[model samples]
Target: MALSCGIDFGTSNSSVAIVKDGTVGLVPVEGDHVTTPSAIFFQRPNNTVYFGREAVQMFFDRAGGRFMRSLKRVLGTPLMTQGTLVNTRHMQFGKIIAAFLQNLKTQTDVFAQHDVLNVVMGRPVHFVDNDAEADRRAQEELKAIAQSVGFRNVEFQFEPIAAAFAHEVNIQGEKLAIVADLGGGTSDFTVIRLSNRYLRKADRAADILASTGVRIGGNDFDKDLSLSIIMPEIGYRSTYGEKHLEVPLHTFHQLAEWSKVNFTYTPKVIMQTRQILHQSHDRKRYKRLLQVLEQETGHTLLGAAEQAKISLTGQAEHRAAFGFIEDDFFVNIQRREFDDAIQYEVDKITASATQCLNQASVRREDIDLVILTGGTTEVPLVQEEFRRMFPKAAIADENKLSSVGLGLAYDSQNKFGDGQP
Candidate 1:
């Protein structure tokens, strides 16, 4: 017997599902939670590792080690081949990905009472937008990682299309639906025709209209909030020297990036910051910057921005604190300011969704339903954009985090049945 399973290795969160005898199911990868945060923490001295919510909590609990989030965003880039020192040994990123996948596979094994081999993995529509070769390489690399982790066979499904499948099972009549899956690392869209007529069809190519995506996502919003409201207090725009020349801002930008934050503590960059600190006209701001680097608090500082972004999802203002940087350090962020900061990213996401419709020769009013998934859709500004576009279309209630995984289970059932390979 074979276990046909699906894995949505998302940017911010992840889930696993299986199709058994036409029934879909999930195993609690962490405690009672089917979905776990896509985070990893490595505890020092022993190099012991933790994943998901536990990893994040350990990170904030002052546990000694390295923390990494948004690992999915690094897949299509050069960093996928790079390595970082976990303890005394350098660990390649490909191995890191395998480790995470292996953990999930272990859970799948226990759920099946045997080794589960046939699997499907979800991928964003555009892993690296506008770069076809790079996109192909990214998919190949991911497939290799899954294979390395003991999967006998692996297949890929576009995330938004997978989400579309999850919605297709619920609708009755024929409808032109748009699926917008905005995750922590990318925003993806799919224009498709959904109906019960095609519910069990294995090939959805003729039903799907168009698929498009861009790399801007929730992490970008976190970065913008960090740079605009949090970085200034840490010498981002402060001046130095008799000329009062502005201090270099590249390091602050790096700190704002989830994938590059660790690079901020490199000896070369730290030395450069100190050289400028000596000439700072105002040492207070630069001192705070130094403190962040010395403590390797890049993730903690950005966590404040992320929390503020969530807090402002419904309110007008949020005061984010960075006591980790200094005692009583707080920054008040207005909703308008947060919206203004992310205006560029918002516009890009809007344009990508428009591109999908245009590619399919579909119009706003032509759509019958708008299926929204992924956590970033919770933001007020992002919600408003969709409302204005598909004013006449009804919004489908989506699972946000696990829809793709659930849909992929259906896909797995279609591609690989109940028999052993």
Candidate 2:
């Protein structure tokens, strides 16, 4: 049997799927989860490398500068200064990404079974329009890395297009559909015409009305929650009694990273805050008790605040304790408050969707289906916004999220014909 694989190298999480026996399915990781954490950690003292969940778990333990996450957003950007080093403090962007992909490859089941793998990966459409040069360079680098890892051929597909193909299997007739992919690092939209089961077969099907993206997703919301709810309770300030509050800033960033990893529920971020305070006050033993109180109070306040937000998605109101350190530091956040926190992002998504509809010269009623992909779509506020924005169209199957990788895998096999020798 020939082996071909499709990979969704997403900003927040990554997954690989394979086509076998004419059926496309997800390739399970060593631990049985189809999705792998999109994290990379470079460890010192032993020169060890970590990827996926293991890397994410080790993030807080490692120095922030040494552990890298969300480099996918930096793709097609100058966010990484030229010649800048990653963990080990001496490698450039190219090397860092290569290492991450290489580690991802090793974690895949196909690599173990196939002598030569045919791989198809997904990229955002904005990567083409906004940063063509950087996008092209990144593609070349990815291809080189895949080839080096024993892949016979590698190709890239627009993420929304890949997602649309996944959706095409179930839906039929001459119809227009909207794909709203709200991933961890970015959100993308694609409006396409689907007739029969084929995509891009004729000039009409090949037409792309509008595609737009923004660098906002679940991580951004977590940051907003942390800033508005947690930091203040911890007595955190940019200036803390003469010394710059650099440690609290670092702690806040760390909590954002932590939020991305542990998305299932609000994590107990108190320990992380404690570690920060301990390190920050290491020089002054007399201030240790105060630092501990600040850390505890901050975590309690932030933890309750985040829980409330998470809860408000399912409940109208959620009550949480905010003042473990100071009795007066309690705060209550209603569903409306959480909604207000994310209103800016909600507006951006709606505007993008409206612009896309206008660019397509299609009325909201013309859209036959809407597919919601990405973790952010799980938020009730986002769902309600999309529903309000596109009331005429029925949302496409919620089951489409897992199928993106499957379609990409099938496409890989069809496009490359099993990586024949």
Candidate 3:
């Protein structure tokens, strides 16, 4: 049997899937969850380490360790060139990513009872939109990590294209479909033609008509929601000193975001925050910000915001209570409030989808199906955009979380099993 697996090293979650007996399926990475949160924590005292759920749980347990999430966001950026210090040990973003990929390989190997050396990795349409060199650099960085983890043969597939292949299996007739992949850190779109007949053909280059993406996704939503709703309670807009100058907002901005949270932990930033706290008019709010810096609880606060965003998906309103940051600290966020906060992103996604059609020279009426993938598509606002854009098209509903991974597995089978690379 070919020991190949499809790896979706997503911004918020990661998963692995394999093709066996002509069937593609997901391999559980943590417990029964095929997709685990893409997070890691280096524990203190003895320097123990954890990945995925345990890593998140360890941080929540207040293990006094270094917690890093959205590690993928560092790729294709200057941050990858300069490593960050974790637990007093200097490590590059590539090394951290390799650690996570290595863990995925170990888990998949144990599940498959063999060494999986070949992989089909999924990537967004563009890691850094319009910058070909940066996008290429991101892929090279990811490919290097894959090789370091023992994947001797590695191939890349656009995440939305991979998803289309998964969706193709269910299509009975020829149709034009648009794939909207709203991931944690990027939103990708692909306009392609799919059919049972096309599935049997080995070549699909011509079928993929147009592809476009933007660096906007669920994480951005979390940031904006945090800024609009959560950050204000923590001294985001307060003034300081007799001059009535606005309090420094950079620290609050970093605190509201996950990828930038670690960067704010420097001594200079801490000292500056302390100075602001001492000179602040609203000591209570600045003190809360100080507590976040002191306790290293930025992740926990963002996690709460993320949870509130998720909860607002099903309910009319949700409350994010940050008792850890401050006693009786809470923010009641209504669905409309969350929608308004993230409308900018929602507009970008809408424009990207329309751009895909225009680039392909395919009219909106010509689209036969609109496929939604990735976790963020669950939001009502996101869904509403798709509905408005492709009002006449039939929507193929697949497992949003696993579609890309599952599709990559199918691509792996086509690449390795059929000897057609």
Candidate 4:
């Protein structure tokens, strides 16, 4: 029998799955987690680029314009601008995706079992009608990329539809499900109805009556956190000459971007900051003074900020320490304050949900289940907001994260039979 695979090329993370012996299993990448980070890093030293975790780690590796993380946003947009020089960074988006797909293919065992690989990829429904001409061109470009990556048969299904299919397989009922897929760069919601008899007999096809999306997710949250907490405490002067004493806010912003994912060790970060400050003062004798201040102020402040965000999810109040910079550098942030930080974005999400419901002519009570996906949904405020909106409906099982890829794998196995010889 032939082997088939399903790929979830998500904006934040990507995963591949295959079915064997009538069961779906996620394909592990390099003995690590099943999902790969959706990042790319260009290394000038070797004139090569890296993808996945390696790329994410090298995000701030002193390479000039060598990192691109959110290229998915421009999938359907034109790559060229009048009078602008184009480089490898300006290469077509589809080709970049194809490169990632190629890397993924090389990592998995899917190619050995089947002479012709059949792949089902998840795409957002919003792309289907994005300015007809541009949308068609984008779809064509994506399809061509798949073909280039060696997939003989490539199929695209709306992401929410795939999530619904995944949800339907696990729960046996005749009811409506709301899928909230909050990925890295975008969040989409879709309402779907499922019936076991309908699915088993292929008599009823699941319908996506309404769908909506916003180009906001976890990355936005990280940015907001950096702005509200880290920037102020760093003593990063924005209004000054371009000297050691006068660092640009933009430079700190770039540093914050790097610090978000890197700089796991607090002491290392403190020491690094102290070194920078000492250099700024132009006095080698003050190096120890800078180190003492950093240890007593800077590290504590940043660490507390991150911890507060994490604690606010489960606790009503959280205090972030900032003693590294000053004696009274502490900042007390209540859960409410954290929620307020993301209030506007949460409102947007709620509004999007309402619009989807209205478009489908379905009331909140009509939704039988709500499936929450992505990391942002883990936020307490987001969870509370969604729960209030869907109090009556059961939040679909939390396992929906990998459900789409699993369903695709199951569908592939059924379509192609077992992989056994």
Report the number of clashing residue pairs per model: 0, 0, 0, 8
Q: How well does candidate 1 match the true structure in TM-score terms?
A: 0.97
Candidate lDDT (C-alpha), each: 0.88, 0.63, 0.88, 0.62
Model 1 lDDT tens row, 1-421: 6878889998889999887766777767788899999888889988788999989999999898888888887786888877777755688888888888888898888877778888989999988888999899889988999999999999999999888887787788899999999999999999999987786797889889999999989999999988987788888899998888999889999899887888788788888888988999878889889888988898888888899999999899998887877899889999999999998999999999999999999989999999999999999899999999999999985588889888888788888885343
Name the candidate that leads on TM-score.
1
Model 4 alpha-carbon drift over 4 Å, by segment:
20-22, 58-65, 79-92, 110-116, 127-137, 198-206, 232-335, 411-421
Q: Model 1 segments beyond 4 Å from truth?
A: 418-421
lDDT of 2 by residue, 333-375 (tens): 5677677778887788778778778877888888888888876
lDDT of 3: 0.88
- Cα miss at 374, model 4 (Å)? 1.7
Q: What's the lDDT of the predicted structure labeled candidate 1? A: 0.88
Q: Which has the higher TM-score value, candidate number 3 or candidate number 4?
A: 3
**What lDDT is reached at residue 259 by model 3?**
84
